[model samples]
Target: MTKRELIDNIARDGLVERLVANVCHRRHRSLPDLVQMVYEVLLNYDEEKLMRIHRRGAINFFIVRIIENLYFSRTSPYYRQIRRFAQHSDILKDE
Candidate 1:
């Protein structure tokens, strides 16, 4: 499938959203941003690679890893861009 087609399939199936929800769990506020970020990352991959992943039935595992890394890795862009700010806001609210 083409890149756009693969992306459409994934989005239409709500795979990214479901994986983000599963990864974020109680962090509901981060769901939308995380899902968007995951899509952005996925878009960086070429159509051939995405198709290979789909053929191997590794799409879910690959996306789950992306979500986990984006959410939990301190050096990830998501951490720097969203989670860090979120943590600071929570701290300020508590203070």
Candidate 2:
């Protein structure tokens, strides 16, 4: 299927909203980049992977996988800092 078709399928299945909200929640209240991330992930889906996600239940599961991959692929010091901050947020919250 075409990239446009995949994106349309994802949006129509309500996965986009779910993924964006999930990313926002998990990424320490960050939502601004969630849509762009999803777009990138969906556009890069390989044929086998795309078929798997499509068969399972559209793009919802695929979005989950993308988020997982992104979290693990954090080579940037920025994401590392966010993770560190997130880990220590409870104590900082009372300050």
The residue-level lDDT of candidate 1 at 4 comes to 82
Q: For model 2, how does the per-residue alpha-carbon lDDT over 44-77 read when each residue is reduced to its tens digit?
A: 6686777677767755666776666555456633
Off by over 4 Å in 1: none
lDDT of each: 0.88, 0.63
Query: Evaluated with TM-score, which candidate comes out highest?
Result: 1
Error of 2 at 37 (Å): 1.4
Clashing pairs in 2: none
Candidate 1 whole-model C-alpha lDDT, 0 to 1: 0.88
